[model samples]
Target: MLSLICFQSLITLSQIWLLAVMSILWIIWKSRNDVKFNNFVISVQRAIGTVMAWIREGGLLIKAPMGNSILDVQILHSLHLKGIPRRSTKVIPVFWHPPIADWIKVNTDGLSKGNPSIAASGGGLRNYRGFVKGFFGLRLSIQTAFFVELKGVILEVSFAWEKGWHSL
Candidate 1:
């Protein structure tokens, strides 16, 4: 199946085909697990429906070319499937307001893989004109979200103090 899709000219079409293949594989694996552990019986039609739905949803996350490619349409047609219509995407414009003169604005964020997993904190210092003054990122050992948040602020504050920017 992969060999057939790999020869496609468009990389985007290849990606869509790959996603469909992965979705089918995932549904099969999940059905096998369900039968093994939960003794759940999934019919053929139900499994196909699940794969179709998964492929449809997963395809949406991937950005295709500007318009539909001929290969894309042909592949779907051959499978007796219809491509999911692209959803209307909404664009929201965001503007950043600079701080007052002689003041430094600090922004920080922390993220962890799991709640108590490996974590990292990062932040940046912006001047009144919104130009970046300094930035820092630290990779910490196992830590919680809350701890990382506070650590980010502490690190940024210490950075600002060291830079002699007291007015934040």
Candidate 2:
């Protein structure tokens, strides 16, 4: 369990770092363009602050998906050379919860051929006790993966409603 948690933490931190790096690079590119074309000169202090702000914003965005702002903040805090500049949050763990009694969960997936050959959509409904309520799989016309996914969801919902499984 500890190893799994550590691995997850590392993955989350790496994702945040990658986002921060991308954001910083974009800011740098924009700053360079302004300096070259518009003759806009940004002070070093301002540049540093801008980078920090972007990093913080990236961390905050990752917080939602990681479901642990404290871990992200701690990683961000360690990135700072001096004292922690920002990003302090109470520890919290957020994990998926099973559907309540009498509720069913619908999981869907879609696939598409890269060569515009065919598309497929599939999904299944599971009750709170992890029993399969229903499932569907179908081949669709050549379409984008997004459309295939949407079709899968629509099929699942329709199936559930038709079967009188409305409390999903």
Identify the candidate with maximal TM-score.
1
Model 2: per-residue Cα lDDT over 1-168, one tens digit each: 224343444555676668778877887898899999999988878877887777766655554333244555555567552222334568899864568999989989999866455899999998988888888899899888888889999999999999999988
Error of 2 at 104 (Å): 0.7
The sequence of per-residue lDDT tens digits that candidate 1 reaches over residues 1-168 is 334432433555566668778988888899999999999989999988887777666666655442254656676565554555445568899987889999999999999878999999999999998899999899999999999999999999999999899999
| Per-model TM against the reference | 0.48, 0.41
- What TM-score does prediction 2 earn? 0.41
What lDDT would each prediction earn against the true structure?
Answer: 0.79, 0.74
Worst 10 residues of 1 by lDDT: 1-10
